[model samples]
Target: MDSRRAFLKKTLISGTGMALSGSLMPQSLLAASSKKITILHTNDMHSRIEPFPDDGGTFANMGGMARRATLISEIRAKEPNVLLLDAGDIFQGTPYFNFYGGELEFKLMSKMKYDAATLGNHDFDNGMDGLLGQLPNASFNFISSNYDFSDTLLHNQFSAYKIFNKGGIKIGVFGLGIELEGLVAKENYGNTKYLDPIAVSREMVQQLKNKKCDLIICLSHLGYSYQSQKIDDRKLAAQVNGIDLIIGGHTHTFLDHPEEIINKDGHKTLINQVGWSGLKLGKIDFAFGKKNEISYANSEPLAII
Candidate 1:
């Protein structure tokens, strides 16, 4: 799970509804009408079917699946162009996972109408068999570029990327995962081969660009950062180009605000992560002006409460 407690504690002290004003807009699009896209996200929920206890804690009485579902439904009601996504670690925290082995998680997420989701290493805790066994319940797509599941049961079960058409706006999304070698138990992972996430992500992004996607998003489980040479989300953002946003998980980093880093092409890339256990839901509203320039950007981390 992400440091939801840490992020919530920081954000509450700083103030809520923090806004970013004055985004760069193309002169040609200044007079044109705008299109709105709302991106809603969560990560590392770990099958928390119920809200946390009311005991004194940062996430107490927060992060119930029902609350999240209600919030998502309300948002959809307000905005027709919305994308609901998850960054992974959807299994193995609550008793639901121990008893149902992720079936409940998949079923619920599917019912929530998730646009897409990536996989976390913990997703293999019950072994590849367990993960693959419950695939039928999830109606959304699983996009991953690094994992070569060809020899495993997940071969055709995942995609490297997907392009979504929303109100004439083309949004492309891909997924990247962490190295499983020594991190994941061999028996649990089976024959799944992990590749270089950065390289694969770059390639996928390039493909999406060639397809002329209006927006590109990367769903990553490669932890926020590390002292070692391990590649993290920040490193990926700096090394790659054309990625508009990186929604990350693993290491459960709760970011109070989205970090904007310059990518290889010198364009800004936004990276955000919500704390784990479904404690918070991340929402970003993008207003696209004429000529496809981003006119406004606002992000809010909604406490499950």
Candidate 2:
């Protein structure tokens, strides 16, 4: 939680006062002042509904959905404006998914109030038709900017981008998925055309900027990084100009802190990913000041113990 404290110190004192006058301000005054938005995210949660077995293996007895719900509830109870997000791979690991075909996962995420999520390679495991059958169960929006689903069964099931206004601060969020070729079976995705993530991101960011978004976040399932010339979150950060934070999935990398990279425009971009199976929750706090000035203040990666 305290990992990003240093960045907060740069915030003007007037902006810092929002933390003091949290809930007791007039509506108009609150709108005029700085606002805080908490972002909680998860990735590669491959249908581990229950905690791991109590055996002495790695992550033993760790990461259950109930515990994650409780933790999210506690945090939301304290923070007025919070966004819950998922990077992807929300299906196909445990027997729960094998039996239910993602109905349970969608029901649980709806109950937990997930704002949005992207697509991962394994999410296609059940195939397009299988995924369509479970769409009615999810209350949250599925966002994918690059994958052209017009020829598939999932057409119009997902939004390319969404804008959320939290405490008068406009936050723009979009999704980026990894290439499905060689990763997913052709029969599974059918005619879904995969567009270049970098190109799509460039367009989305410009649109968000045009809309005067105070913050821009990319929910990515392109993995953290790779040795070869594969497009990862880090590469996207370097290429994209306006993305402020990238909540990523795949490769199941457990990052203690977000990797900060300077973009082509020399603006800072953050990339954070929690390990698979819901062992931990990644939190990023965005505090907004006058004009479009913003600060990525704190990160509280809480373990679901």
Candidate 3:
């Protein structure tokens, strides 16, 4: 891996691109078919079926699945193409998880029409069989590009990437999970091989590019930036090219807006994470027109009130 500065310098010389990469707009949200798309995303929801009580605290009376559904419905009513995504940690936390063991979570997300989600360390709380047992409840796809579940019960439960067609725009989406060694118990994730995120990302990006996708998104449970050497969303962005945006979780960091980074190819990628507990829904509106023509890629934090 080259130093970021060195990579940036080579990119400049070879015209690998400084703003956008590979003959395409990096952060496109709209397609040229006179259609607009809305991306609705959440992360680390942690089974909060109901909002927090009005306990006179920071999250008082906020983050209920009902409110989130209403908001999503409203958006779908207005937008022609909308994609709802979650970045894992859909299990555990609240009493609902303790009582229902994630059935309700999957059912609710299915009812809300979630497009896809990734895996988080906590999703393995009850072990592989536990998660495999609950798979029948989720209507959406689970994508984990780096977690090799070939030897586990989850072998047939997920795919590495999914391509979406929205208003004529082909969007390539994949998932990446955090390393689970210190995070999850050994028995819980038995025989699930952890692949190198960077390598997997590189491969997935090439596949997506070959598929000729207009935009690429990563549903990541790898958290946001960390001060330590622990790999995070920032590292993913800096190392890989072709991923247009990253919807992240695991760290529970709240951002007023998405963070932008220049990738290995010198293209821009946006990283966004709404605070956990379903209190806030991340909304980004995209308009696509003309090849290689850049759009401002809207990033708005929509409160589910």
Candidate 4:
């Protein structure tokens, strides 16, 4: 065990651009009764179906769906338990969205086999009807806890939360969207009621706990932070308990590492976000003990080269 710990410490220190966080237990300590889950996530893709042109811009020739797909495939080939998720803004930005109304984007994500996604304000750029029209192109679910679509055409189209069993470990995931009133046009998101994220998060935690999930994740479209009183991922992490991780979007913040914040119950919650346009894919590996308790976690953002 001591040798394993020393090895892990040395590897971490030698690893470039890797941020080792959370409670870490040496792999040897739990090798006989441990499982590891790798979470691959993205945010604010905004309809970037192809790589940026080699036009000498900052992100020139950087982000592309094809590169991301190849990277994800490579990881899945090596990892037994993996989850691919998005924090939303899947539509609106490139000419592709304008031409196809998000059909191409959804199709590509479906091809990549995304497990789930949340809603971003820009997702409503073409309105609810447009979003509904492209639903058939997607193979995965959309989970949004705070946005009530009861009276819209999107009623019952999304889940408040979903549970998954990966390698005998139960993982719970829920979603939260930014308030769309002013950011989104009234006609675009007609009749969709925005609920309080904090309140909904507390309820989700209790419900997932009752369901005996070992890990709970929040797919949040809330911005990373704000000077004003607007609720952001950081604020949500500080106020809520029981959320193991918060995958954030909407502000297009590029975080090289996941920020660890102690929550209301004094438990640690991790928050991470990659900038918009599919430039980077955030990866977090969590190791669980025999009892499904998280023993170790580490994060790194893989650039889509």
Per-structure clash totals for the candidates = 4, 2, 5, 0
Q: Model 2: how large is the Cα RMSD against the reference?
A: 10.4
lDDT (0 to 1) per candidate:
0.83, 0.85, 0.84, 0.88
Say which candidate scores most in TM-score.
4
Q: Give per-residue CA lDDT, model 3, range 258-293, as digits (tens).
A: 888996578888889998988899998767666623
**Deviation in Å, model 1, residue 48 alpha carbon:** 1.1
Best of the two (2, 4) by lDDT: 4
Model 4 agreement with the true structure over 22-72: per-residue lDDT tens digits: 436554553444588899999999988778888999999897887788799
Model 1 lDDT per residue over 40-158, tens place:
99899988877888899867787887778778989899787899999989999988789878877887787679999999989989998999898877889998889999988778889
Please give, for residues 91-191, the per-residue lDDT of candidate 2 as tens digits. 98999899889877877787788999999999999999999998887889899999999987888989999999887889999999999999999999999
- Those runs of model 4 whose alpha carbons end farther than 4 Å from true positions after fitting are 1-33
Q: Estimate each model's TM-score.
A: 0.89, 0.88, 0.88, 0.91
Report each candidate's C-alpha RMSD, comma-separated, in the order given.
7.8, 10.4, 12.7, 9.7
Which TM-score value belongs to model 4? Answer: 0.91
In model 3, where is the ten-residue run with the lowest total lDDT?
A: 15-24
Model 2 regions lying over 4 Å from their true place: 1-33
RMSD of 1: 7.8
lDDT of 2 at 101: 92
Q: Residue 109 in candidate 3 has what lDDT?
A: 84
